[model samples]
Target: MLTEEEKNAGLVGRIIPINIEEQMKTAYIDYSMSVIVSRALPDVRDGLKPVHRRILYDMSAELNLSSDKPTRKSARIVGDVLGKFHPHGDSSVYDAMVRLAQEWSMRYPLVDGQGNFGSMDGDSPAAMRYTEARMKKITDEVMADIEKETIDWTLNFDDTIPEPTVLPTKIPLLLVNGASGIAVGMATNMAPHNLCEVVDACCAYIDNPEIECEELLQYVKGPDFPTGGLIYGYDGVREALLTGRGRVMMRARTEIEHTASGRECIVITEIPYMVNKAEMIKKIADLINDKKIEGISYINDESDRNGLRIIIILKQDAVASVVLNTLYKNTPLQTSFAVNNIALVKGRPMLLNLRELIRHFVEHRHDVVVRRTRFDLRKAEERLHIVQGLLIAQDNIDEIVHIIRSSQTPDAAKERMMERFGLSDLQSAAIIDMRLRALTGLERGKLDAEREELEKRIAYFREVLASRDEQMRVIREELIEMKEKYGDERRTEIIYASEEFNPEDFYADEDMVITMSHMGYIKRTPLAEYRTQHRGGVGVKGSATRDEDFIEHIYVASMHATMMFFTEKGRCYWLKVYDIPEGTRSSKGRAIQNLI
Candidate 1:
């Protein structure tokens, strides 16, 4: 705190002493909050960052780039977004718009692009000047009721034009297309889900707000990534849905196939979400060249417009399953996605679980529905008032016409009508402005029908405005309608993890012959290496030993079988048969101590 004299001195251009540490602390806090609220995080209700929302709004409201309209150049959209709404770099705005059009990036794309918009191989999109874009048909849901005073509006950067604080999106966009961003000290990584599942979960919550996360899981199941893959377990998914944070294992979808030459190969049909296909393939190649992973003869990337297909050919003697496990271990073929459900709630960053996200969307819809109903109700009442006055003039058509014609001017006619019919100013003005044809019998009946319909509409709108249940019903109906129109089956598959799983299951199960020398040397060879011979025929030497040592133990077991060796000191060791070193008939066996 500055004293009076010091404050006065500072105001008079004299420097005042201050703590640099305190100043730094305050400045950093303000900066971080700005980034958190204005830039990095997405709003919980709309599931859009500031940039994305601005781009969509500019395209639809400013450029009129609707689905049915011809697309405008991407550069024009980006320029309008920067000038009127988002005052950011052109690249950031264009990149965000491009991502919205990418099918592999978004579960359900919101924008339709005319030119190159990149691919799953991590290619950059063409420059804005070369591309064109328009809002997708589904984006209408996000912009619906926007012009009906359904949401609050704020001035843009220069305060010259007003923009909405948020869109009136009927869909639970936050969950349907999850968000990711990095703020000052935190980051968010949400997972996208199937539209049908998210809608089902949200509707279920609206029907039962107190529903637990466990029950919601029945509808959501798990994240349905756009790039189809396998979710290894439910533990992480359950944690994320209930606690807002967890990690799930993602693995590429692959199948073992055989070539015309009878050689086995692994065919990858799908990869984990957000993993770059070309980069993943390159990583595999690097690993193979470095000898970190072996057994692969070569790899072929067969990805095209049709679909993704990566073929990994194995050597003649290599085990296909073992090679696959190694690939998963050493490459991006198997990865883990961290779920961090962070978004802005009422202008503050918050970590929300599945149930909270659904609840927020419902509440936002309720607000928009109420506001929209109020607007509609007001409009209907005003129309109803005019319709009532028109009906009165139709009944007294000749008298009303005589008064209008006898009056010297339009103003005089309006005043005469008001006095005769006891109409309000608006009603009198409408009556005077009525065309001569409106007095005909056919037009009179049309007025009566419109009045009746307006009365019913006004009453319904009032009910919706006054009753929360009615508002929720409207929201539910709209949600179901969107689901029926846009929902799709889940792309990602979730597999339950078992606790008793063994790593050895990935190995080939075959018979092997184990041999041990009296000197405590041990080795294993394939059972096929030993040919069948008559009893009288001399048996082949299995292993070479020292001059004084001789064979002591021999046995046959499957590659997956466990072997136990007991020592004289009452200690026991267990090992899998496949873990043993394989040696030729004339080669010396490995030391037993090393084997154990």
Candidate 2:
């Protein structure tokens, strides 16, 4: 509604008409793009979201929290981040910071924390005020040559300070540490990989950018989780590497042990990635209380700082393999990790497969190396110019000293030196600022040696900048150096087969004799228990039976062989030889009806 006076002033048409639907569509898209590009997804180059990048930058650049320095309070770090770069809540920033330090979360922890960060049992970390953190030694690689202007910078939230758009990390952090996040209508869930494997793959890619994903797989077998579990098969890993999306089955590492009381127990040493230990134990307890699983007698979590250990005691009559399989079927001990490698590339979300990921990292390193070399080359040239000026002064020491003494002011002396030697302002100033001791014989020799080294470096830097091959060689060398410094063995194991696990796979095949009596008693005894003896030795008892129920049937079969039973009432039952009750030569056996 326009006012009458405004209408008289011919302002009636100021309120332009537009479709409400169109406005909403436009606004919603704008907001969605904001979340997708600016907040959620990690940049493919550095493998970090905005908040993570901001925190690292503030710690490294603003606070100088290097690995060698004393740790600073996490609250102080969060405060600086919120005030300078990120304007979000303090909790979000603190959580991200804590994750960087938690070994369970990060394949290679970026921050070295001095207090409790978190645990695999899903415990929350202490408050920011109670914790202290400094950057890890590996994190120094991320901030390497940052001051050399190897990457772009953008203004912070309030435009008061500038921050890096992406870290010029030397390593393929995207693959080495992985990333996960959710944004408008899209999400990313990448799995961490072994540093050595990733570095090897990266070097191979730099040698040949046309390398296929299959070749890359030879280097990186699969995701090497920080928690160290077993990956059931490689098919999902292959698919994810080729197409950037797939799910891999993960199972806890366990072994069967016989207790002193003759009962069997299953011992779990490591669990799947990101699964909470305490919650998993609780789920197992609930399943037991609900009678969903019956073989276990009790469960105990004996995990400690040394490693993860969970003991599950089984009943005397329980089959260890069956109970273990049941647990896997019903509990988080067996889980699937979906790999969706979506990340930001040039401010747009893109799904990156293995080769694309390697290519992006190589290209980024190429850029950083070029920029760093150029920066170094410039500084070297500037120093070379000043050194040339000094060498000239040394050669004409008497004349130079005479000019300085004759000039009325330092400004006049600089002008006269520049005019006489055809030197630039920088070189002239260097000559004017030179100390008397710098003109000594030893100092002059050092100046000559430095100039010669600078010349060689300048030439090499120029060659690297002009030749792509040289740049790649440099990238390869740096990756190898980093690998030698930090690479370690893969913790997670990958099985090549895709078949579902069968409980029978855990059993061994052996010759056994099955004996049955007229009273429906059945038992299996290993053939080895009846070894041939000398003529004077007595034979072992074949079966202990009642006088009314003598042995009526005897059969020999392998432990894995299946047996079918037929009754006169037209009923049939089948069982594996290993599943039959085992008894000593003099012991009575279990009833056949109970097993069948």
Candidate 3:
């Protein structure tokens, strides 16, 4: 809307003004799209970002180092991927590769490292030069048929090489080994699951696509962390599997036992996922010194190559179970994992729940299988053509030989054979160049047998390529085979302990006297603790009081009852009677306000 006067004022020579807010919004949107698409999020089909896929593809295609091959130095693979495909920092590439090699980080590690790749104690991995890595045996399921044009490819950073947009993975990589990434304005933290369970659920879905997530949960129970612990509730797990996000609570597996000195000790056998052992120990020590925790005498880390053993010694007379609960409340013994199952679907970020994720993987597998079958059928048909040509030449070898001998040159013989025998150029050329032994009846039979086998294989491949059911069957078969070979038991044990071991579950149902004294003292004593006496005789002290206070209120209740206390200001506090302090006839009770 500028006039000729503004244009003449030197505003036309790149000094034109635009709305700063609009430009900022446009730039931010562009950057966010870039991050979500090309940088942070993983593809739903392959469950890997560009860098991870590029590293694997570079190892498989460029270096030709498969699972069976000898491991190469990590630096070589990182340098190749950076210079060729991922044009990023070497440290980023190395860090990603190291995570793939870490068993503690991934439930099913994609790379097998020969040297130290770090530990659950927050140790740093060795330098890329010091560590050698190769693809795991299971990675073959992802890399299989990648060379058969089953997946799409794009130009590398320099355009000198081509990299796969996604791998043709048969295994459900997303579920087996979950993903975590932070992009612009969004992030993802998917929980890992058991391979066998996932495969079972996949088979079930293939059999019945109408099965919902709740039904699928029967086969696939919940997340299985590599460093095994215990999941407390199933509600969160169910919510996460049904919806796209939920928060599941996890706790360390600890065993408490009484020593010869009559002291209880906690032996930590396994910790929650991703909780640093050294850091956790240091934190507990700090809490003990700060007097934020009671009953912990000392902590000693007895971890070694054999296994992890963290010993937490307790002071004498400390309630072991109570102390355990306190630790769970105060320390990192219990943690919550947020499940945000977000991934890129067709270059767009999508929040997918369990069922949709499985469906996507199934669809991807179908395409890969179809493409591979087509490739196989094409090659089979070509070989079938050549074998049929040889069979035709064998049927009339003497005549062909006479024609060849009479001809002046090989080209003339080829042309004569093509014209007289109605053979195509390829068939005619193959006949002329046929081996001498191939003229014998035995060789003829061998060629015929090969042709027959190729026909059968071609028919099968065609059937698979034509039928969707056949493709799904192939997927199921591969899944079962993978389960037989590489599947492991679930590591993270999901316990309905919250439903089973509540505050009242530890005690039996019994009548009790709930008493509140005038001095604000409250206690619960079993009715059986009282003895029968004469009506006017002096009875036992109802509750021992120090401030000349008497029992002002009394109520008969069960030990499993819930008691609510109302304050003068109408503030309410409630607790189970089992949580109330037990008092004897001669003991002064605890203050109700303090107890509540």
Candidate 4:
């Protein structure tokens, strides 16, 4: 059924073979590049990928942050972003934006949107048009300089629209808000940080670009997640930042509240990040149904429009701490965030060590500063050139105006000014502006002073640029030293307490007796009165005969051994060797000797 051309093409493979090795190598390279560009590296300018940035940008454009207008419906913004920028579904985009706005989801949300953006209880936001949104002051300030060409732009996937290549973020978003993503074989998870703390960290980076990771820790205590849980140790944080992989434990907070009816309730104000409220409620329900918790009344989510107020009502006089400990032991009340991936280098996915992540960010900041300085210098030069030309043309205002009026173009007037004032093109343009202002004296003096200031600024910028490489080198060296000093490979997921305890109690001597039997159970008798106690039991009158009575005793020992013994009832029994079961105390009974 194949056409002649199709048949020929199919047969070509058999007739003219291709190198499979070369084809595989080419395919692998393409896959690696795709992962790096699409998943790993966040654009330096925008601090977001196409999806995230587009959502924020669309929201800003529709809501008009500068206007006193009320917030627009979130549904409308989602529709626009999905239609124009991201080709994803409206629900997905809206959900992501809603998550971003939730204070509990992010440590420092980029948008200060109003309305029910949902809660830490895992309630999904209403449809796009139902919930309203607007950009925060911080978001506007961070993105303000973007329009002035402070950053680069690249085409979107369809190559039809231009998207900002990177965010011209004044603050390092990676350190501040952090990010998490998965792509192919690699993934990244970074904890959220406080805005104030991140700002302070950025300032520290600026002041001393060569600061070490330990020194940087002075500014960033640790990740301050919006959920308000405690980070147990500093070592995990240090490891995650350095090697891009570490785990931290998080626990939910609970308070015991007593009602007028004398019933106890555990109020959970804060829950673990990323935990689903509905799921947790179901879990608690399951626990109650399974009889895992006794003396309990009800579990209520009780979350309202304002915030989370989950209340777990208990039976009257129930032990609150017991319930609390049980929740921690069995539920999502205690969880962990496993961080293992990074996004620092451009177009490459390299596993970041903590110091390396900081170093890369610091270096990127320097690059941004240099680019910004260059941009400013160019604008100053252009302004200075025009001022010089205008100053030279001040005396001949009429003639210059006549030349401007008579010339077919502005360039001809510039040429005339150049000839008449004996000025270079830049100086001529500067003088021509002064002639129009009618300032022959003050204008000339002002232009000279302005030119000198511009030169000084440019010179300063050059000096800063020149020292950047050396500064980066020094910073790298210091980070290396800190890594060498404190860099320890993580051994366990759970961070252990560092306080030392006395081992004397653990090694204390205790008396133990051994009893051997054929069946599996060890019996021990006291060592103090072995012979006397046996004689006393043997002489008992009208009691069960010694040959017919059987007995067992508790044993405590550091080691295991087997012993055979005859009961007072004349029954012979054997005990196997085994260590004492945990949580058992030794008995003070006599050692049984022989049968009757």
Candidate 5:
């Protein structure tokens, strides 16, 4: 088809319309793939992405591996990584490095960088090349294994650089201290766990591969965030671990403190993880500025080099309970972390249940063990074959010497021995190499012993290979049992599991006074005070004054409303005072009415 404009210009233009829906879908798919590959997917061992892993590796390579040392300028490390391995700009890399080193940011720091890598006070780090960098020992050890081919590798965008597909983590990092990331349509926010508990769980799995998830829970109770808040309920933790989706509640710590100035203050020591310190401080300041709080003189952040010490100074007469309640009602002091994502097997995005993640890791480890064992077995078999050949030629020293001196290669010598002795390849290779002259007299026995050891190892390898499936099945069954026992969905709210108690002495005396009034104000008077002040009233007897006078008090629950009024004359009336003008006095009258 051709448009009118094409006809006017004496040219024909074909019109091929595109399906907008199809185009949009294609674009979205591309975007999602980009996010999944570039942003998420923690390397199994190091538990970090390309950029994060590179930053740590570069820091370790440049800075001294000690947090105790004076911190290196962060800029220096950023420059090294960007210039060498990571092609990203200095600013982005530096920001990420600073975040990792900042204690307030990450639950567990992968880099122990020193200097002003920024502060929890919303401070940014200095420029790249100015701030020095160093790696934490944990990062160093983890990355060191990378060079040993413990993990797979893939090419970079240009295929000029090689990057690890995933790290060969010796530990179950997913549970040790969990991870969080957002990629494409998926995101991850696993909670940090207790180190001791995780180690125990891993050891349990190893000892009895058939251990159930429920049994494992006995060792690992629940996620233990570094922030040290109560888990409230374990159901969410269990669900997230099991199915990789749940929520958990967290609350800030607050306490009442008596200041040296003879006034009270509310002190906040710890905050929830990832809570913005600057924003929180500003919010509190706004509350004070608005006069929403009573008797709050000032708010100060005494949080210094020592630690976090947010002090809310109160007026000398302010009620502490009211102040505390106001804080809870107003701020992000209490929040919840929603966990609903998973990262596993490098680039493969799996919706992991707690049991599923553990199973995946176990499977990977099993593969590694099998591959290592096979490699070991192959080398041992080769050595055993050579020893067998030497054993067969033990009596023919001259012939063996002739074969060795005459043959041009190890294989050639073995072949000649095999034909001359009418022996198998293994026997021929063993005899050709087992000559005492092949080693000094002292080492000859040692060589023979090594030959026997190699033969035994080969036999063992064959036996293990034959029983591999049965062993793996046993391990898998044990892990499944552990998961069943401990893996459960989190019920975030608190649960109290006990019967209610009723006690005879539960009731206490009520010191409260109740009054019935038709007006907004009800007056109360103490007898002793009234007697002392109104002793000379007309028509009042001396004994009457002592009995009837009371201290003056008023209770006004609300203004402009009908009130029920009760009087000393043993009368009651309902007064409609909602329209009564302020400062007006009512006639002193008493009336009584009874319902029919």
Candidate 6:
């Protein structure tokens, strides 16, 4: 007889047979799909994942947390979301909320958080109970008109409440906010773009649906990171925009400033997005310690609320450019964001290029406009019916008064008015319910004016619904409005970047013992390797040379210190200790003539 576990695994009475290998493969695939769809990837429409969407919706709709509303404790919002909609851990919900609030993280932060959210130094945000959060004004645009039935809705995880499948965003949030995620066998990292640049590019694409990515590049140069940095590799950006994938190099913007002591300091006022200032300093210190980089004498993070300032003091006459370049090469000061524009498109994951992304946004805008217009039209028509009834009652003031006074009940008066005025049941009800003050001259005139404006607006909405060009015009106008209000200068700058850079940078400026041979051979070995011994102990041989060549001279210097050389011809030349051929204590050195 099989064990209980084996019996359960294998075919038993009323049990179905299946291959274990196939089941494992299928289960893993299913789990991967679930993670990719529900956890990692964002929707192309709103540029938000399930958890993010739930938090925003719960905050905005359920909690009535608008941009102007008083901020509520993050713990409350997190708890509500976890209990009602998301059904996820409190940390995940709070983290998503925190990222939405962090200006360093999101190009356009959705949440207006009070108290400490976090810092660019990669500090953790305050506890949920400690922080307060509310929606930002622009997030209104993201969740705009959602209540007007502009987008599809889905039941929550528990099937108790309905939630929007995607937000009815006014702008192309995908480009504006960007996204980053890593899933099984795949990952996505979309760099944020400038609001103005993105809007202009979107409008350009709208004008010419066949517009190439290069043409769009005219409007949108490259990624506009929230934490401003100097972007290089324009070609890489263009390729990413065109093909949905490429790597754009980012270098921290730094200025070489003169300190009080007249020493030149590399002041890093800005850095690449997501680089922690504290960790970056530690990394540079590590590089200096490990003999991987040279010339940095001291590093201090003088960052404050005013702005980020990481001061890297250099040695006297140290090549600032070389030191900066070395820092860029070895640290997070220079980084590359790999653009993989993957997002969920209509419940399926898809990689979209620039034009496709713009087109999706424009299409969503058009759909939203249509739904909004219809909803508005229905509301205006209903109000128009009530207003028309009021106007009719105002016109027949005597008859309405007589009918109301003669009837014993309100229902009898409503029936009599409907029969006499040829009004619909709703119109008759409005007439019977009319306030006495509404019959005044001012009220009648206000009603007439409202009626005229409603008719005019209703006609315009119909026209917009009828023509695609008109719809596009509205999109263009709104984009321009958004640009005028929210758009600012692009933070990240793109320049032509050469791919090839020196691989070998300066190492630690460590003390070393230099030795030369009569044959003009030279070598350097660490000074520490020469051990101190009793007077009777012979000095350690620091170099190996040819039989005919003996050690003529030795000097103690740092690896980065300059070495002056005088030839027999009375000519002088200089070389750094690192420039000399490095050799072990027993290794013969190479000829200096070959090195120079």
- The digit string of per-residue lDDT tens for model 3 on 41-121 reads 889998998889998888888888889999999999999888888887999999999999888889999988889899988
- Sort by lDDT, best first: what order? 2, 1, 3, 6, 4, 5
Query: For residues 107-179, could you state the per-residue lDDT of candidate 4 as single tens digits?
Result: 5576656766775556666666666777765566446556656667777668876766666655556655667
Off by over 4 Å in 5: 1-21, 41-46, 53-86, 140-150, 203-218, 230-239, 304-306, 344-348, 378-596
Sorted by TM-score, highest first, which candidate order results? 1, 6, 2, 3, 4, 5
Candidate 1 CA-lDDT value? 0.91
lDDT per residue, candidate 1, 259-374, as tens digits? 99999999999999999999999999999899887788899998877999999999988898888887887789989899999999999889999999999999999999988998
Q: After superposition, how far is residue 296 of candidate 5 from its true place, in Å?
A: 3.8
lDDT for position 273 in model 1: 91
- Candidate 2 stretches with Cα past 4 Å from truth are 1-11, 501-596
Worst-scoring 10-residue span by lDDT in model 1: 498-507
The alpha-carbon lDDT assigned to residue 300 of candidate 2 equals 95
TM, every model? 0.92, 0.85, 0.84, 0.69, 0.65, 0.86
User: Per-model C-alpha lDDT, please?
Assistant: 0.91, 0.91, 0.88, 0.61, 0.60, 0.87
Q: Which candidate, 1 or 4, has the higher lDDT? A: 1
- After TM-score superposition, the amount by which residue 214's alpha carbon in candidate 2 deviates from its true location, in angstroms, is 1.4
What digit string (tens of lDDT, one per residue) describes model 2 on residues 401-450? 99899999999998998888788888878888999998789999999999
Give per-residue lDDT, candidate 3, residue 532: 93
Candidate 2: clashing residue pairs, number: 0
Evaluate residue 113 in candidate 6 and report its C-alpha lDDT on the 0 to 100 scale. Answer: 95
Candidate 3 local distance difference test against the native: 0.88
Candidate 4, run of 10 with poorest lDDT: 499-508
lDDT of 2 at 123: 93
Better of 2 and 3 by lDDT: 2
